[model samples]
Target: MNFRELHQDGCFLLPNAWDVGSARVLEAAGFPALATTSAGIAFSLGRADHDYGGGRVDRDTMIQRIGEIVAGVGVPVSADLEDGYADVAATISMAVEAGVAGGNIEDFTGDRARPLYDLSEATDRMVAAKEAAGGSPFFLVGRTDVLLVGGTLDEAVRRANAYLAAGADCAFVPGAADAATIGTLVRELDGPLNVVMGLTGGDLSLDDLRKLGVRRVTVGGSIARALYRHLVDAARELAEHGTFTYADDQIPQSDLNALFDPKTH
Candidate 1:
């Protein structure tokens, strides 16, 4: 199915990949689509995720990385454009130019003192994004960090509905992991619902979320963080214990090569 159709009915898992290699590996694993995680990309570039303190990777760099992933994969790829890189119009245009089929524009302002955009300003940004997409077949996901920034569920629903009315194809509430909140949003919102998985108190199963009427499920940066955790553990073991046991569960070279081989793919 096309990327847009993925949000029409049943829920599907949209895993975030940090680079072309990871994107290719995920596509080989049979996921229908992929997303570029801002955190993952930042970590790969030797920086912290959402580098609010400054020194974040620039927008052009992100667009280039996203384009590489699109070129490397056969399935649709969406991007996690952190605050639309601070310019809604340019970010949307660059994403489309980079061959992205979908992308999210969040309301987080990257300011610790004032974390989120006001509801009206946020809705206007979404409108600008939708207009920038023009006649292209782009799925513009309107995301609100309200809950993530400690706002109430009611406010989240309010902002989500506003964004949808402004022309968002989907509304993403990152911190609404519990079944009740997810269900409420699904019932109240007019468009497809996108939820991030593995939140502290909101770890519902895929079947559970689907039953709750969720349309899209993404892991955000959890997969990248988990993989990095394993990497750290393995490195610590080898460095501190002088053991090679970390290689025990590694994928064989042949299998990895087969996945990357163009003809095989």
Candidate 2:
């Protein structure tokens, strides 16, 4: 499916998936496309988001997981390829061939403490991604970590437009708030707009966002974080009181296994 056309029809809600299981579940639940959540994926593998995919996430492993999700579900899979996962080693061609229909190479330098890459460096990475995506173009979501990092909204806009000129298929401002700013961003940039919808930020309804001209909404690890929070709280309760009470609220492993069962014999 071409993202150019997919992005044009209407607002596409892209709930980020962590692993094949989550991807399949979302697919079964009826999401048209899947984008990997960097935080979710890293957490699943016992790490944190942003370059904690062991700092590199084994390019082959990353590509293979993306391919698996693509094959497992009949939808376009966009990998959150965090800053192309390399400083200078990654080439544009390698990224395009990874079976990803789209991707986000954030300007974040992997630090929740310090959020964006230097503007020039970030633009270069987006350019490399564009060259990598080639003719069978996929949506390259260029994320500016402005609000998340400390860059001003104006600076984010400047960098975002620069990325668009550098060949980004879409521009994502991960921490922008409100419909008005989002509206301004959509108008200012030349490509699709990716707005992050989560608990703290981006609580706008689909209708409101469409009115604001947002092409896509990415729920980056909100679901995963919610689940993780539950697990942590449950574990804390158990460790503090030695009670198995939290187990009552859990999904059965058997049921989960049943859900992953193949339709084809």
Candidate 3:
């Protein structure tokens, strides 16, 4: 099935799963699809990475990792492909062949909080990515960082619509996506809506997001960060005070084992 169709089926949450274990748990919990969070993967690798900004991975690495997630769960995976991780058309061409059901290409730089390209250049990049994909009809999501870079929702909506016009199958406005803003974008733009869930927290439930016209919702790195925070706090508490408060609130061991059972796959 094509990504547009996957997006059109009402509100679907693509909970970000860091590794095989997390992916398996999400699959067992019955998520319709799971997308990889770049932040989560970076942390797993012990690499100082932020999506594609910190360091670019070889095509083999991306393919192997993405394919692993796709194989681990019987569901679609939309990779968090940061700007296709390259500036050249040839590099982006290779990225489109990575076997993800879809991906989001955000115009973010490593240290800068703003888009790396001018509006026109960003549009051209998205167009190039679409052509490189060879009409397999994958979701070429164009993400606007207006909110992230201290810009307005109206600006984000405009950028999103422009991205849609430039051939993105869906437009994603990460950071500070509110119901009113999301609803406004839905009414203003005429394609699929992809919003990031769980910044501080998802202000709306999946059903609520759908009502605001969001088709796809992703939780970004919150899952990985939450897990990290627990681990760090637990370690600190034990190192200093001898306690396991974080461990007490953890998921049961049986559930974890059950989710990763070989037979499940």
Candidate 4:
């Protein structure tokens, strides 16, 4: 199914991929759609996620990576366009050219003084992003960092609804983890709500999120972080203890080779 159709009703898990290999693995795992995690991409490139004053991976690099991931997978992929990199519409246009099925434009400004865009400005950005899609099927997810930046839930609800009114297909409020809070957002938002799980170290399963009426659940950069942590641990073991026990649970080389074969895909 197309990415927008997945959000029409019911709930689905949208795993975030940082590169072509991860995107292919997620497609092989049976996820209908995938989303790129800016944090994951930045970290993989030896940079910080959404670093202060645009230090995170530049727009050209991000678009190139997104294109590579989309080309490597059969499933639809959404992009994590961090705050649109100062040009909300142009950034989205670039994402569309990259062939993403959809992409998110977040409201989290890097400045600590103004951690989030004003509601009016954020709604305008969503409108601009929606227009950049040119009425295509590309899903525009409006992400508000209200709660993530210590704002109130009511403020988040308001900003999300405004974005929806401005043509966002989904409202993503990432900081709410509990059932009650999620349920509240679901009940209050004007349109479908997208939540990010695993980012805050929670036990909220897909079933749990489904019960709360969350239309979409994404893991954000949790998977990437876990993989990097594993690599760090393995390197430490090899360096300090000269042990290779970390290879025990690794995927067999043959399996990866088969999975990545062009003919197999």
Worst 10 residues of 3 by lDDT: 87-96
Better of 1 and 2 by TM-score: 1
What is the Å distance of residue 211 in model 3 from its true position?
A: 1.4
Q: What is the TM-score of each candidate against the true structure?
A: 0.96, 0.87, 0.88, 0.97
Q: How high a TM-score does candidate 1 get?
A: 0.96
Q: Which ten residues in a row have the lowest lDDT in candidate 4?
A: 49-58
Clash number for each model: 0, 1, 0, 0
Give the distance in Å from residue 258's predicted Cα in candidate 4 to where it truly belongs.
0.8
**Candidate 4 colliding pairs:** none
- lDDT of candidates 1 onward, in order: 0.91, 0.76, 0.76, 0.90
C-alpha-based local distance difference test score of model 1: 0.91
lDDT tens string, model 2, 9-118? 57888888888888988887777888888677767877655544245455566666666677777778887777776742253355456667878777877665556778
Q: What are the runs in model 1 whose C-alpha is more than 4 Å off?
A: none
The candidate with the higher TM-score, 2 or 4, is 4
Give the residue spans of candidate 2 off by over 4 A.
51-58, 87-92, 111-115, 199-202, 252-255
